[model samples]
Target: MAVGATPKIRLSLSEWGQMFIAFGALAWPMIKALFGNAPWRMFGSVEARRDYWRNVALVMIRTGGHWFSIRHLQFMMPNDRSACRLWGWMNWTSVISEQVDMTHGAGEDSAAKTERNPSIHWVGQSPQPVSTTGNNSQRSNVKVVLYIHGGGFVLPLSNGCITMMRTLLRETNDPSYGSPVYLALAEYTIAPYAEYPTQIRQCISILHRLSSRYGVDPSNLVLVGDSCGGSLCLSLLSQLLHPSPKLPQLPYTKGSSEPFAGVLLMSPWTSLATSAPSYTSNAGSDTLPPNVIRRFRDTYLPKSPDLSPTSTSGAYKRVDPMQVASLSGRYYDAVPDPPIKGLTDGAGATRHMDSFDAGNNKNDEWWKEIGSVAKRIMITTGEYECFRDDIVTFSNDLKHANDTSHGKASEIELLRDESFHAVLVSDFAFGIPPCTLAAKLSGWFLSVLRNPVV
Candidate 1:
C-alpha cells in the first residue's frame, strides 16, 4: 500500500503468516524508537547487531512494499523537493558568489555557507598539493570518487552513506601524493517526485561536470555505489560504456571518450523485473524481505510484468526447463519461458537460466561495451542476499561479453561474504567499523592508480 499500488501477485497463506511474523518482529523496534534506545544503538557487538539486523530483515520481508512504497512516503515528498530545490539554488549561488567574492577576499561567506547549508553537502578533503619531488608525474593523475547514495530510490541519503564517504575520503587521502583523492557525494532526485531516468541523467551531468569543470581525468576516475545507488552506478556506467540515442546524453560528457579506471559495485540490485533464487532461498537470512525487493522494483521501474521467459505462462511451451537445468553449471544462452510458479510454491530450486530477458534487452549492448573496455570490475555480494543470483548472473554475463570482445580472458573479481544485503554500507549500524571495507576499496584504487589501465 505504501507503494501506491497493491502487490503484483496474491500471497499464499504461508506468505501471510510470514508477513504477520514480520509485523510482530518490527513492533519491538517501533517501541524502542518511541521509548528506549534504538536497536542498532543498543547492540554494541557485531553479533548483537547481526541478530538485530536479522530480525529487521524478517520485518522487511513481511512489510516489503507495504510501508515504504511511493504512496506511503508521499507525505514526505514536499520536504524532499524543497530540500532539493534549496540545494540547487545554494549550489548556483555559491558558484556565482565564489567568483564575486574573489576580489573582496570573502572566505567568511564561503565558510558560513558551508556550515549552514545541510540539505545535501559535499565533503571534500582537498587533495594535498603534490610536492616538487621528482615524482611530479603522479601529481597530475588524480582519482575522484563520486559516490551516489542508495535508499531504494525513495529515501534520501542515509547516515551510512555519509559515514562511508567520510571514511573513504580520509583513507583515500595519500599525503604522499600531492592532492589526495578528491571525493564528492552526489545527491540525486528520488521517485514520487522525479520519475525514472531523471536521477540517471542527474548523475551523468554531475560526472560530466566533475570530468570537465573539475579537470578529473576519466582514466583516473572510479565510480562506486551500493544498494540502489549501486543500481544507479551500473545504469550510469552502462550509459558511459555505450552512449546511444535511445539513452539520454549529458552535453558535457558527449564528446569525451575514455573509460573509467575501475568500478566497485556492493550489493547492487541488478534486476527489477523478477525474483531470483536468493529471493526465496535466502529470505530468512537476507536483511531485505523478498516482497520489499519486489516493492522497490515496482515503485521505481515501469509497471511491466517480468516477461523473463521464466516469469511468463509461455515458458513450458517455448523452452525446455529440463534442458535449461542441464546447462545450469555453466552459462547457457536460452532462458526457458515459464510462469516461474516454483518459487512461490516453496520450491526453492535455483533457476538454471541466466540470460532471460528481464527487460534489460536494450542495455545488452551496453553490457558488451563494458566487457570490451575491460575496466577493473569488482562485484561483492552477500552469500545469503536475495540479489545474489542475479548479481552472479550479471557478473558472469559481463565477463563473457568482455572475453568475447577482447579475444582474451576478462576476469571480473566476484567476492562473496557470509553477510547480508548492503553489509558494507550497513556495517556501522551493525557494530562493524567500515574501516576494513574502506581499506579494501582504497587498496583497489591504489592498485589501479599504480598500474594505470590502458
Candidate 2:
C-alpha cells in the first residue's frame, strides 16, 4: 500500500471461491440453521409455533451449536412465566413484522388477505376520499400505523418477523400502552435490484397506495421501523421532507395517505451518514453471521449493473449504516450540478459505467455483484458481547438527529442494557421480566401507533 494511492487487492477465481468457501464454512450453519429461524408451519397451533424453534435451538445449542441470529438465540431464553410475560404481546405476526421491518404496513398490504379479525378496521380519515377496494363508509376514526421491516437489502417477507408484528399490534392496546393498537404494516424493496432511490420510492408508493384504500390521515399516520426498516422509515421521512428535483413527485393522491402522525423506532439506524460509538464497541455481540447487522457505507453509491459478471470496477457500492461516510455519501449523491452540463438525465449517471459489460457474455459482472451483495453488508462482530452499542448509538443518534435538524422533537426509546443485536428479541422467550423489558422499545412504537401524538 502506497500513501495517497489505493491498494489493489486482486485474487483469482479459485482464490475468491476459496475465500468465500472459508467464510461460508463459518457462515453456513449459522445462516441456514443458526442464522435464520424455522419457517412458519401451515397454520400451526400457537403452542406448536411457540415450542418448535425453541426446542430445535435448545437441542442444537446443547449439541455445540451457538446462537447467531435472533431466531436461533430464542432457544437460550427462559420460556418460563417471565418469558411468557415478556413475549405475551410479541407472539403475533404483527409484532414479528414490526420487529423485523418495523412497520405495520407490510401486514396491511392489499395483496395480502389477512384473517378477518374485524376487530381491526381502517382507522385513517383524510380530507379527500382514499381509493379502496372496500367501502370507506365502513371505516372508523381509529388510528393506523406506517411500519417498516428489516432485511439486509433483500429477503422480502423474511422469516420470524411475524411474531414481532403481532407483538406490536398487541402493544397498541396493552395495559402497558394504555390502549389497543391498530396499524397498517408496509414493506419496501431493497438495493442491487431496486437501486438507490427505489428503496425510498417503494415506501412512498405504499403510503400513497394506502391513502385511498386505508384512508390514512397524515397527522394520524404513526410511522415505525426496526433495524434497517427503522432507518428506512426515517430516511423515507427525511427524503419526503427534502425531495430532489431530479426525482419524481408523489403527492397526496387517491392512493397514498398523508404523512405520518408520529414516528417510532426500535434499534433504529436513523443517522445513515455517520457511525455511532457502538459500531466497533458492540460488534462482537451482534448475532449476524457475517456483516448482516450493520450497514456498509459504500453500498449507497450508484449501482447500475453491467452485463458481464467479472467487472470489479463496476461493483455495486453497498454501504454500512454504522459508518458516517455512507450517509454523507448520499448527500453528495444528491448534489445538484449546473444545468450547462450536457447531461441527458439527472443524478450524474453511475449507471452502465461497467468495469465489465452488461451485454451478453460469460457476464460474471452482474453475477459477481449479486454474489457480493450478500457478502458486503455490515458484518457486525467483535470479540466482546457488545450488541448494546448498535441500538444505543441508534437511539442516541435519533434524538440528536431530530435535535440538530428539527430541534430534537423526535421521541425514540431504547431498552436499557440489552444486547439488541442477537438476544434482544428473545427476552420474550425465557427472559426475566423476559420479553417485557425487551419488548418495551417495540411497545413504544405500538403506543405511538395506537395513540399518535398530534
Candidate 3:
C-alpha cells in the first residue's frame, strides 16, 4: 500500500483483535507480578535492578512496542488534531492552525506537491509582539520553547510529551528561574502518513511563523525534542546550517542568525543503524527491540527510486536518509573516540583532539558554525539505553566542534543517568517521582537563560 493510505474498516477490526491478543498474553505475567510470584531477577540484568513496579512497567511497555504494528499503535493513540483539541479544553492552553505557504521560497514545483496546514499547541497564553524600543523591552525576559515530539516518526503527539512540556513550563517560571516561559508544541505529519522533507517543512514553517509573525527573538527561542523528536531537532539544525538539496532554503527573520538560547535533547536517536555496541549490550535493558527499530527506520525512509547509473544526474539524485539521519556521522570524518569512563554527570570532559588535525578536518567550517543556531546544547541519555553509545559519541563531537571553533569551553553538556530510554518523559507519563536527571534538566534551562552567552 502507498504511504499514508487509510486502512479499510475490516483491516481496522482485525488490528483491534490482534491488539487484544497481544495484551491478553501479558495478563498472566501481570497477575503473577501483582501476587509477588514473578521475581524481578527473571526480567533481565538491567530490568532486575529497577524497582518492582518499574520492572513491571518496562515489561508492559516493551511488550506493547514489540507486539504492535505502527498502524495498530496509531489507531490506539490520539491523532494530532484530537490531541490539540483536548489540550485546548484544559486551562491555560490554546491551539492555532497556521497555513504554510510552500511557494514562499520553494519554487512552484516543490509547492505543488502537497497542501496541509500544521497546528501549534500553546501551554500558556499565546505570545504577542512586544515593543523593543526604549528600556521597556520584554523580549529578554520572555523565553519560548518550541518542542518537537517523538513517536518513532509514526505515532501522533503523545500525552507524555505534553506532560513533559507542561512540567518544563512550570519549572522555568519559578522565581529562581525568573523567566516567563511560553511553550509551543509543534504538530507534524508522521511516517506512513508522510516521508522525509514533509515533516521538516512543517517544522520550518512553524519556526518562521513564531519568529516573523509573533516577533519572537531567535536568541530567546529554545528548541527541544526527545527520541525521534531529537532526530528532527538535529535535522532542522542541519537544514539551517547546511541547506538540504531536497528542501527549500529557510527564510530567516531579523536577527535570525543569532544563536538560539539552548537546545535540550532527551535520549535522541542519533542514527537508525543498530550496529553500535550498546544495541547488543543494552538490548535487554532498553524498551525498543532491534527489529522494531528497523521497522520504523524502513517505514520513515523513502525507497530509492529506480534509475540507471547513467541517469542518476543531479536532477535525479535523492536525499540520502542514512546521511540525513546520522547527524554525528555527518559532523565528523571518523567515528569519535569512545566516551570517557565515569563521565555520566553533566560536566566538561577532556577533548580528544589527538586523533584529529584541526586544519585537515573537512567539517571544521561546519563545526565553527554551530553557534549560529544554538548557543548552548544539553543532551540527556540513559546509561542502559540502546542509543547511549551514539549519544555519547555525538556529544563529544559536538563539544569539540563548539570549543575548537568558538574558543568556548563547556558549550555542550551531557547527562547520563542509570535508567531506560526517554526516562524523563516516562517519569512524567507514569507519574514516577522526578529523578536527578530531571532536576538537572530544569537547572540547565534556568542557567542558560540567566547567564546568556553574549
Top-lDDT candidate index = 3
The TM-score of candidate 2 is 0.49
- Compose the digit string of candidate 2's lDDT tens values, residues 258-306: 4345665554543332233454554433443223332231233333343
Model 3: worst 10 consecutive residues (lDDT sum): 346-355
The stretch of ten residues in a row with the least summed lDDT in candidate 1 is 95-104
Q: Model 1, range 121-238, lDDT digits (tens) per residue?
A: 3443433334344522222466777677666775565545555655555544667756666656665655534435545656655665554444566667777788777777776655
Which sections of candidate 3 miss by over 4 Å? 1-11, 33-50, 87-112, 129-141, 175-179, 253-256, 306-365, 406-410
- Which candidate should be chosen as best, given TM-score against the real structure? 3
Using lDDT as the measure, name the better of candidate 1 and candidate 2.
1
The all-Cα superposition gives candidate 3 an RMSD in Å to the true structure of 9.1
Ranking by lDDT: 3, 1, 2
User: Which digits, one per residue and each the tens of the lDDT, describe model 3 over residues 241-315?
Assistant: 655345545544222556778888899877665567897788778876554565565566544353222234343
The C-alpha RMSD of each candidate to the native structure, in angstroms, is 13.2, 16.3, 9.1
| Each prediction's whole-model lDDT (CA) | 0.51, 0.37, 0.63
